[model samples]
Target: MSAMGILSYGLTLCFVLVTFYFLRRTFEEKKPLVFDGYYHPEFKPVADVFRQNLLNGKERGGSFAVFHKGQCVFNMWGGYADNEAVRPWDKSTLTMAFSASKGVAAVIVAKMVDLGYLDYKRPVADYWPEFGQKDKGNITVEMLLSHQAGLPLLDEYLHLRDIVDNPDKVERVLAAQGTVWPAGTDFGYHGVTYGLYVDTLVRKADPKGRDIARFFREEIAGPFELDTFINTPKSEYYRAARLYTQPMWEMLLETLMSTRYFPILGHYILFPDSLLVNVAKAVVEFTKDMSVFNNPDLREVPLTSATVTSTAEGLGKLYGILANGGTAENKVLLNAELVKKLATPLSQGTDSVIKQENSMFGPGTVIMKNPKGQLMFGHSGHGGQVGMADATNKVGFMYITNYISINGLGDDPRYLDLENALYKSLDNHESNIGNQNI
Candidate 1:
């Protein structure tokens, strides 16, 4: 009876605390950036949708960019990247683009495939023999791209060190992992596994034996003159923008920061096994500044999971090249057929781990499952970073942000509201409201 009373008291206290927390947040004015509806002549309803999004301010200091025929049609970003309401975020401010870097990394594989240097149908072990450990030798490049390789997280018990400490050793250990399921029988997100695969393949394919990050700069960023990085440098480390999850934005970071690596360490916690995490830590330790994580960190690092940065103008510009079938400004990134190849989703069966079917995947892209309506293909990185091209209409758009939304998973009103806006903006009252967000 005594213990029961204690348990009841604890439960009541927990309930009260949770209720109090929710009530406190209910009135918190997160008003940072409201929407400004800019409309194209034919797509006027998008204006109202944009206005609504800005008013909500769920996406802080984020960008919305559009391109038609490889040219910037509309690109805009506003708000505080730091949320002190002090430093005004600008078009030049870059953020860790999460998995959207996969799209950039995929372009290299497409290039290799185009040159006939890599075969999608061939075994990955053909390229890296050591990768054939366990029953994985038969897994093909297409299997990895489709998330059907049966290896999601590394099989070994893992922590931050195993996840972060060393990549080369991690590769050797991972390459030997036994299949969690039969190859090509499931679709599960690769997460860090994708990075390892891309990095190894890139080093093997490139003349300089470089990582995907360096290959991206040379093949994509340098050629297109875009600003971003996969392997960030210590040189431009001081110009980075600080990102917050929520609520903590108003606090002076120095008070809340750890002595070891404050401020910049938050980004590392958010995006694990990423260049942003490493670079942000280095930048914070060396310069003791939060801005180091915001500048271009481009170098010779290979990351398929993170290390992409760009303005809306840059995104629109790259989409233009993609829209033109991989040629921008007379420089061919890849061929038209290869772009179509990228748009095609490899066969993804049932997944044993995540247990979700990847209805859409094209190399590293996430195409609209029903592209018949919009003919859309592009990629989305965590933290709301997105790049897309409408093949049907030849229009492209890129949305960049420094944060991922945890509340966007289901029927939550906030999630519904944001997704509804995207589809409404797409349909102009043409699509069913129920079908809008998906």
Candidate 2:
């Protein structure tokens, strides 16, 4: 062979070897960002499975936290916050935990009830007179929180511009829409509408006229030193997670067919004559573009029902307080009586909005049912985020992620695996609830 040809062949061989090395490294398991906790020896498998999930590339960016009796038992994070996988997810990374915001919003309202400013049995119109319009004067606060007020859908479509620029107009429209069913008759998931209602009611009921966003900041998030937020501040914007959008074909299929992800519009498109089709139509109009989640302006708007930025630790801490009878950091945040009410189930059965069976709801929270079919109070977000408090077990569990998934209604496999680990770990402790105020 000529000397020039030999040099070219050697160069090609070097290139192939380098490419192979990189490929092997890409397929290797990634180390978790943070893993700290004390679990029984038996719970090793739980940690192993969690690590295996990252190694298998099933997760992108996320965090999981478990608090037993106000003490953090397990806290773990892995993956990247950005879609480009350049930024490693860490203790500070935050994302929109979707419906988990509902649980936090409910906690604020429950505190209001504890302070004697609101009553679940009283008509919501008693505080906000305008809300009494359209024969809604009799809808009680409890009924609305329990997803039973029957005003889950809006009669008119809403643009994001309207929700951001002129919430009052949207509020007025909500006040005027008649309930699809009589108040307290049946139940349906209110989806995004509940947030608007709760926002309006909290502002009216608050003596200082603070809106839900402000109230949560001053009363809950700030006082508790939580990293969560209803309207994420500008300074924290850089730390927000950039979610991975689903494959185009999958998104289109879900947008056209699934009610859980697509909201009311998908259902209306699939079954126009079905019950609550108008609600679906309204949801479709509001969510006409899923790009809204990717917009930076989303952090500026306070969509408490679905758009609160939070971490697993933040969510778990909040739920841990609730699980410990509303006391955290030696502060009595909620009265025991009110805590009991929050834990009580207000509605159960097939949810009209999601079209799922055995779904349970409480005021401002999604009461999750375990594999055993027993209801535990908490909430799950649209992607794969979930936060739940088992008062009986004194366990507050949270899982947050950036790798968006479609199995939103407590069926996500990652959530199930973590949930199983949580249950098994419970056997290692006698009872942590007695000694700690957390």
Candidate 3:
């Protein structure tokens, strides 16, 4: 045989072997993931449904956890945490649960409200006196949480770093803008700013004036005994889930135009004057080193919206508190009355840009209100972390996917909109059962 022909054959043979090796590594699975301690009588059906619907590898990867009566009835995750990891996505891998972390921030703020340190009606200026400047003095804490504070996206100039490490950077950027409309006359989604609101409220209220990351530790996250956290620890670095993005985002230059798939890193851009939210960002900027991100100290930096990582158990536990009447063990996270307040749907208006009708501005959460007024409130993190609980049914749940997004929707190919649809299903099902029981 000619030398060239032989070389070509050899190259093709090597490629085939490499492909087979990876394929075998991916498909060969003797160890079924530890989904639950044991099977549940009720969840056998539910598990079958999730296995058929959410799992089965149709989606890039996804997982779901359901907490019934404060117990995890169904918890399962199966897929690649990273396509390269060769490790199965398990219960321990944490995803950045996007806006869902805002729900967490809301809980922290609500705790302060419960302690009589804050009133939603109070002007933000009351605490941070400088916030009163630039006609912002009248902007209420409640308005900020509800996304009706009249500031939507941050000024375009600032990047994620400006918000994380610099003090007064976010405030200066935002305060420069005029209100979109008079504050509180109409409602819009705060998106990223929601984290800033919650963070600000927590700092103003905490005796030590703790920032966002610490609030997660001292109040909501650490207290819940979940692995979830806004700022990831260097010690826990090995277990942290790595992230990937849709191709469009990776394709763009730093100054490139936005696309449908461009994940607003830190959830909705590096909003400036986002006092609380950026303080919570603990994401590893690059490599395995936790200190790669701007703030290495968990106490100093915060990226409340886009940075926290959590397992299903941790998120479910936090939601369990909201599902229950505001108490997780000895700690009373919020008053029962406040959970009602938190869940109360703000007036629905066109989202500043997303243009969805179903979105309702709640503190940290977007209230899932159906046409019939059946309500289920939970938070969704940036990638595929989803948690929703129907308080009326006393069920709280969490689903975290290391595969953040494939198309515009989460990585799950099962239902393009499964995050919202499943939530609606839980609300509808519970409402029907309630009506029948009554």
Per-candidate local distance difference test: 0.58, 0.76, 0.60
State the lDDT at 373 in candidate 2.
56
Collision pairs in model 2: 264-280, 265-280
**Model 2 / residue 236 / CA error / Å:** 1.0
In the order shown, the candidates' Cα RMSDs to the true structure are 9.0, 10.1, 9.3
**Ordered list by TM-score, greatest first:** 2, 3, 1
* Residue-pair clashes per candidate: 18, 2, 14
Model 2, stretches more than 4 Å misplaced? 1-44, 249-269, 273-291, 371-374, 431-438
Give per-residue CA lDDT, model 3, range 284-320, as digits (tens).
Answer: 2311232233233432246665566677777777777
C-alpha positional error of residue 408 in candidate 1 after TM-score superposition, expressed in Å: 7.0
Which wins on TM-score, candidate 1 or candidate 3? 3
* TM-score against truth, every candidate: 0.71, 0.84, 0.73
Ranking by lDDT: 2, 3, 1
lDDT of 2 by residue, 161-231 (tens): 46669878888888889988898888998877888788789989999998787888888888887888886
